[model samples]
Target: MLAALAVVALATVSGGAAGGWVASRDGAPGGTPASAAPVPAELVTAAGKTVPGVVSVLVGGAGGASASGSGFAVDDQQHIITNDHILAKGRNGSVTVELPDGRRFAAEVVGREPRSDLAVLKVPPSAGLAALPLAKPGATRVGEPVLAVGSPLGLPGTVTAGIVSALDRQVRLGDNRHSAVQTDASINPGNSGGPLVNARGEVVGVNTAIATIDGNGSIGIGFAIPIDQVQQTADTIIGKGG
Candidate 1:
């Protein structure tokens, strides 16, 4: 079964070719590709200025079955990016974004891409939205420091720091395979969909999951969807193909 799974994964990555897999450095499981280096610190602080536009998402049903996660505005027109699982319950839900100034606004779903675990949302510009610039995902490097900003466990504006543990990590989501950026950034349950910014504050990834030992908390291993795929998925969602 494992060999069959590997064959299927190779086929998917190679687009039906015989040898398709995520490119890695030195044949390591979590090595950086020969692309770009880490972002500088000054740039990260400047980028941090935009976190006020990141918001918490609340999905609910008619009788109030709900789940919550974090997200950030990506475009000036109130377009936001988040995890598709955060909105998996369908569109009959509402999102609330808390600005840095302690203001909040309601939002709606624009599009979602479950294959990539990303979702785009639309809220009024009056919500005081500030969008973060997307960094090149191919540039991520192992050992680089990163910061994750989100409402972890429902605590708004929580910030955590860690290093990029690896790059080009492959993980399974439903029937689809995803290549992600791995970090030791201490992401919690509510941290899903938040931005994982480099030292320069540019968004290199979106916090997705953390490895748990005893079903408790992070064991220094976490993963985020790469920003490159996030941009492509967001574009498709904006085009109404979520």
Candidate 2:
């Protein structure tokens, strides 16, 4: 099932599904696993460069309704890019951004486009956030390794690795249709609006949605808004007094 995603009010994450999978380094059946293999050097370098620019977006709505998602710094002006669905759920309530270093600040909505399912926000210049680098338009290739960085289920600064499963995939986002960058990364609630970066630490897309089995958790299928579209939309918004 394809469902719009978000973590509401920082809801509690269930561990029932997590208990089902088991790994063993010694090849023993049902035995606990030893230390996992070392992460590749490229991925380590990518994560190091990416994490600091990502932030946790928390929205507080009326009657205690709220939603959480992830966003990344898009420019030196502290402009941010995130999913519009996150703001829609908040119903025009206050928006707060939390940096990776535990600093929090109020954010102002620059603009939002429902058709693109994208929005722009700006923080004070004092935030001093470093903007993430972006890949060239149409530079992404299938089978290339990628990283999905976000705050899944409210856990901030989380990173998952996978490959670009496909590109130019037709998908419905909100009331509009878009050609998305498909990936096998583990995208869950709170991962919305985060960056799907390439091996060189350059953003290729914005992680937005995932396909689930029988309305369950992610089953390795995820989708992202291509960076070209994101950049265009963000530029348009920022240009108009953002």
Candidate 3:
């Protein structure tokens, strides 16, 4: 059955988990059974590498309206990439970015491309956010493992695991039609604009929208803007000094 598409950005007042498992012996007291499936080491490593680069974007708009979503550092220049719709929800209001460690900074809107559903924000150089690596152009393949790293439901530093379910999936984002990388990762509200990274900790796409049945929550189907488009648009916005 066809499902409705949601932007995955949470609208509310500004407010905002780690994934790790310890291996236990066959009968270790109060420990997970040794027969339990182990978490993939690659995914664990990727999560660690990605969390620090991801940030929570809080927008305070006119009349106390606010919206929150996720973003990731893209360059050493303190530029962060996020979904433009999140900014739209705030009615062009002030933006703030909160680091994974709880440090918050006032952010300036560098630029936004609504058609592409992407936006860029810049914080002070003192923020010292780490830039996430991007996968090579045309590098993503179907069936590869991936992680959706973002703040789902206002919970910061959240990571969900899944695989590339399809490539070049046509979907509507905002008012534009674009191709997106489809995955089964659990992309919920507040995950907008966050990075979808591969097992090697390289960004493959920007989590943007999810298809939900009956306006419900994520049903294992999420879409991300391919990283190549993100890089091109982000570069143009940065170059134009927007």
- State the displacement of the C-alpha of residue 55, model 2, in Å, after optimal TM-score superposition: 0.2
Give Cα-based local distance difference scores for all models: 0.71, 0.84, 0.87
Residues 1-242, candidate 2: write the lDDT tens digits: 65554221111122112223433334647557689777789999999999999998888888787777889999999999998888887776788999999999999999998888888989999998899999999899999999999988777888999999999988875557888998998887788889999999999999888876555567788889999999999999999956
Worst 10 residues of 1 by lDDT: 7-16
Candidate 3 lDDT tens digits, 1-242: 65655544333334421122322324435746568467799999999999999999999889877888899999999999999988988777899999999999999999999999899999999999999999998999999999999987677898999999999999875558989999998887789989999999999999988876666667788899999999999999999974
**After superposition, candidate 3 runs with Cα above 4 Å error:** 1-36
Which segments of model 1 are wrong by more than 4 Å?
1-47, 89-92
- The whole-model C-alpha lDDT of candidate 3 against the native structure comes to 0.87
Model 2 ranges with Cα > 4 A deviation: 1-31, 34-38
TM-scores, all models, native as reference:
0.77, 0.87, 0.87
Poorest 10 consecutive residues by lDDT, candidate 3: 16-25
Q: Per the 3 Å backbone cut-off, how many clashing residue pairs does candidate 2 have?
A: 0
Error of 2 at 43 (Å): 1.0
**Higher TM-score: candidate 1 or 3?**
3
Indicate the TM-score of model 1. Answer: 0.77
On the 0 to 100 scale, the lDDT of residue 220 in model 3 is 89
Model 3: clashing residue pairs?
110-242
Clash pairs, candidate 1, are 43-200, 44-200, 44-201
> Which 10-residue window in model 2 sums to the lowest lDDT?
7-16
